[model samples]
Target: MLELDGTTMCKPGPLNPSIRAHSSTLTNKRSRRIKGCGALWGEIDHAQGVPAMLLISIQTLLRGALMVGGVSVVLAFSPLPVAAQERMPMRIAVEGAFPPFNYLDANNKLQGFDIDIANALCETGKFECQFIIEKWDDMIPDLIAEKYDAIISSMSMSLERRQKVAFTEKYYNSPSVFIARKDSPITDVSPAALNGKKLGVTSSTAQESYANHFYPDMKKTVFRSSPELYKGLSDGRVDIILEDKLAIYDWIANTKAGTCCAFKGPDLVDVTFFGEGAGIAVRLDDKERLARLNEALKTIKEDGTYDMINAKYFPFSIQ
Candidate 1:
């Protein structure tokens, strides 16, 4: 006879002939189950018969552990998303010598139509802008070297310029005009009409290019700057001076040199010489910044800011 001291465990009783055979088979099955448990679950004791609830608990623990392990592995291998970066203040380059477009006042501080337009663009773009005065000759190279982010110095949009940098839509366009003393009798602008006349133009400007290309027969004198060109006209060094119509008009109304001159015949503008018009220039690689600038330009033009600026500088529309 066998007895369980504290637990209510089942016990085998005495058996007759048929019951003895069944008892032997049941004992054999119990031994096999115990052996299987020892092999797969060595920590579980099987001599007292395996507990059904214990097997359920083990399965639940194993499944939970596997789920946690899988989640940890995925988290270790996966990459997190990165945040967007903010842009720095943009540095804009302008030619201080170009008046009406840009120039220095009596205080030597930069002020002009170009400067106002630049400020408007920056304000509309929601970005801080700093204007730096640079020579027109070195503007493109300096931009490529990252010295400045853009040029708003009345730079004409040309195929030759597009090779090195990108340009926004034309901000302004004006026809080139010839200026002569009101007393001078230079009326016709035809090539044949000005055969013996001497023409004065700023060097490296569209006026000079036009003079050389179309009126090669006329005597041409090139000056380094606008003041020099006007000086040549006032001094009688040249019979007629070709330049931007609006700029000359401003000079005539404001400066003493312009007082002696008046428009000779007609306003001349050819895309080959003057290009599409003056535009803001940026480095070719900076497409994103250029896009922002273009957007800002459109915003200002549509918001009445552009018209206000035009009214401040001129009695007529220059847009």
Candidate 2:
């Protein structure tokens, strides 16, 4: 007759998914027998009487075995165990340099609409999140390399970018505008009106691509950063600036250099140049991660979280 922990081990009954077992105070005298029959037919050695920790592995292995009905199963499990997996935090990436969307405050802490949106998503999705800062140009490449998870930077969703990384639904769409000195007479956005004028745009962005494609005749001056472009504009180094309208709005309202510039003409939003809108980007192969972010984004928008963040940043809807 088969014996287990001094009890006759009969044919094992149907295994319960939630299996538990208890053991007496362990000693070096002999290996201990598990009370549960689900662990198949093995004696677990309780090292230094630490049944508390070994029992957990015993239960997990038993449970995992029960999943396959008495078959010895070899499986890799997370070091966190089942409960800890639920509390694991997600890693998110952001440029951390784009203000109004995402930037460091006076105290050098991350705070802005983009950060708020990321927090809201984490709340709605019931997951913890940690934001990481990456350079504007390396957002996509680093994402693919798995340096971080999702990107919440104010990255425009363009065809060229879509080819590299997957993007969630657009969070907001702001039109592009041309800004020049208030005294300047360039009122038209047409290439004919501003052909010979020097135009400044951020390097490697949709704005630069737009100017290069449409206004090829215009002297295109690419700056490495927004501040540099604005400096060029303020010092009369560039005759015009074309970029996101909301960014331009923030500049004009708060910065001294922006005071010298005003909107030149109507908003420009060609899909060919701008793609769709700004969106959160993720790794191309991470479909489930993408789905979770989309679900979180939808929940926030439906529950007014998005509106609250928007109002805190802009007076009008940028959506």
lDDT of each: 0.67, 0.69
User: Candidate 1, residues 1-319: lDDT per residue as tens digits?
Assistant: 1111211112212212121100111132211100000111122121222356955765565554335745632222221111111222566676666678787666445667887787666655643455555555667888888876788888877667888899999898888888898889888989999998999988777778788988999998988667678889998999998998876777889987778988888778688778788899998888877777788788879988889888888998877
Error of 2 at 8 (Å): 69
lDDT of 2 by residue, 19-43 (tens): 2312212122221111221111232
What are the TM-scores, per candidate, against the unseen true structure? 0.70, 0.72
User: How much is 114 displaced in model 1, in angstroms?
Assistant: 0.1
Total backbone collisions, model 2: 0
